[model samples]
Target: MKEEMINIQDPILQLKDVSISYSPGKNAVKNIYADIAKNKITAIMGPSGCGKSTLLRAINRMHELYPDIKIMGEILLDGKNILKMNPMEVRRMAGMVFQRPNPFPTMSIFDNVIAGYKLNGISLSKSEKEEIVERCLTNVGLWNEVKDSLYKKGTFLSGGQQQRLCIARALALKPDVLLMDEPTSALDPIATNRIEELLLDLKQEFTIVIVTHNMSQAARISDYSMFMYLGELVEYDTTQTMFTNPKDKRTNEYLSGQFG
Candidate 1:
């Protein structure tokens, strides 16, 4: 299928002929080329096992956790190829939030927000740590609610609060891009709405790339939309255009509930 293209003047992330394979001769993500605009929310939508999560994980080098996974082509972040950069640095620059809220069970809310810094062995003065914790928590709209309970374990918060805390942790690193893999799929409707609102607010400062199964959520929150099928990017356009006038048969079918 011919993919629709859009011009981005100064994209923060560029995927050039990117492909991933879990095993030899079996590509899971096939030759995707996209230039993701900065400070915008781009939603990747598709059915199960269509490589949306695989592509999102590659942005932060999460696939490295499995040595068998192989990735090819250049994933550029801020004009530098992230595939060539150190995984630690790449991850720090492209922070991720998973499908579910996963705060460290043993750590306090404050500690969870700064977990990335500690895990990376980056030291900061007590004052600096306090500042970062407060700033990040405030950013995710958790500070006022959790300030009195900062020392409580992060897992103690409600599911939505925990997810927000996870988002705060990602923000603590001040990443250039925020990669979310179905961030709201595990939350209640109320919680999901909060996250959607937070994401909109967040795009003002950080670029967002999200993989979502919920087309409504994608339409509601994303500025741009990408539809993938069978490991291939089938269409990409502004959210307004793609949802109302999708170019590909697959995209239209998926949007119309004819198929996933």
Candidate 2:
């Protein structure tokens, strides 16, 4: 394991009594409230469809892409309601990485990384853009592999490389928060380990919230953990306590693999 690099002092984003539904009648994430430790990783774990990803998607306002989804309650990012902000604006502040690696297949690697700045209507000079891409790639632990062939098609890269490229794309925007949904579930153990290392390095500069089914991965990398069950937050606690001595019996049972 790597030595600590994150400054986990205060809460960066806090969800205040939040409830989200796919439609007016169907609940996906319900009364789920949590405080994300600043400059640290907070992993959300639960059974499938238990609102783990739903809660994370809500944080970045991705659910709004679906017309039927309606989010209620306050999501305070630095103490502001994220739902009230513009959808694009919210996403910019909190970048997302989905389950599958989703680099633009047709775009060149360099162009794929610069996609955020180009699409966001933000302008940067050639030198500045190059520097941004290089720095972000380095941050995501991919610079050494792609620094020379950056102009080649992004899809030419391996699956792990593609995932890290997507991470670099997110980092290029220099977002304050990074939300990941099953980021390593698709990769081999070796690739997954690399991503976990990259994430450990990343939290020194960004807040990270991950939805993961791998309890061992969550225990290995996260500073804090939140347990969800049936669309509700059952408990939130430090990783050490959550794994070693959870106060809630439900958390204990779930972590022990009795029932998830």
- Residue 124 in candidate 2 has what lDDT? 90
Q: Which residue pairs in candidate 1 have backbone atoms (N, alpha carbon, C) closer than 3 angstroms, thus clashing?
A: none
Residue-wise C-alpha lDDT for candidate 2, range 185-206, written one tens digit per residue: 9998999999999999998999
- Residue-level lDDT tens digits of model 1 in 213-260: 999999999999999999999999999999999999999999999988
Give the CA lDDT, 0 to 100, for residue 240 in model 2.
89
Shift of residue 93 alpha carbon in model 2, Å? 0.3
Error of model 1, residue 152, in angstroms: 0.4
TM, every model: 0.98, 0.95
Q: State the displacement of the C-alpha of residue 170, model 1, in Å, after optimal TM-score superposition.
A: 0.5
- Please report how far candidate 2 places residue 74 from its true position, in Å: 0.3
What local distance difference test score does each model get? Answer: 0.96, 0.88
